[model samples]
Target: MTAALFGHDGPWTEEEYLALGETRQRVELFDGSLHVTPAPTPRHQRIARRLGNVLEPAAEAAGLELLEAVNVRLRPDRIPIPDVVITGPIDLDQVNIDAADVRLICEIVSPGNAATDRVLKMHYYAEARIPWYLLVEQETGSLHLYREKNGHHVEESTAAPGGLLELTEPVHVAIRPERLLD
Candidate 1:
């Protein structure tokens, strides 16, 4: 499904979206809706990159890998490009991702995505049974961590700019929230 809606007639698939490269906006498909996102501000990129720097090496040491802004296949036909994802046996090495292969999914919230990140995406990720999901809010400089439980997402913890987000499995990494604001 490479058909994506740009304005009136879209909902393009990944291939179609890529074909129209260099657009000022980035779009992702979630629950069949075309989510058009604004270009990342420098602040957003900085935070995303900083988080990657902190987590990537640790994931590798644990026999896992990290992917940035990669499309994850949550179902046979549903894909949501998350800001950061960590999993074992990296497949993007081949240039495409099999979403079911994802272990953890993270998103750094933008102004347009506060509701989606905190609510809609939360349900979707929970249903997919992703072991862990992190939501980083740039405006608040906080991180919200959720872990799947009995087919639902249970809020595991929340950390502020100077606070620590501790995890027990996959890599045992603790994040410094300020890293997400950089």
Candidate 2:
């Protein structure tokens, strides 16, 4: 179910991928291959921003850093830019933040790249041992929170527009799915 957007002819090294700087589109590395996705739509950006607004104060109260669209180096060959990440303090100058510093990673599912957000990225985040993963469905205005257990992800909870999306691990926060959609 994975698409080979780049490195179709052969595998690519991490250094080679990094050299292609400031792309207009989003690029990710998986298993020594490159996956490029188009820029997110305005709606997607709005949702991500709203979710960040809700999370920022909670994260700050818990003494965690809230970041958006930052590169996470899960491994030398695997670097994925998560839409939202809550983690410990990080050095801004670092090329890519180590996955070990990450506590929770959230992705706003894009209409065109839903599979990459729901499937591929889920597998990669679980493999990285990130404690919590949040999947925000752009079309349905729902949120699915998964927790890592035994090196895999288990659906911890889910909420629709009226329901509250609450989390205790990584940080304590409560948000409504409807707010994320607006």
- How badly does each model clash, as a count of residue pairs? 12, 0
lDDT to native, each model = 0.76, 0.88
lDDT of 1 at 59: 90
In model 2, which regions exceed 4 Å deviation?
Answer: 1-9
TM-score of 1: 0.84
What is the per-residue lDDT of model 2 for residues 73-128, given as tens digits with 9 covering 90 to 100?
A: 99898999999999898897887989999999999998888999889899989998
Q: Which stretches of candidate 1 lie over 4 Å from their true place?
A: 1-24, 93-96
The global Cα lDDT (0 to 1) of model 2 is 0.88
Give all TM-scores, in the order shown.
0.84, 0.93
Question: What RMSD, rounded to one decimal, does every model reach?
Answer: 3.2, 3.3
Residue 130, candidate 1: Cα error in Å is 0.8
Mind sharing the TM-score for model 2?
Answer: 0.93
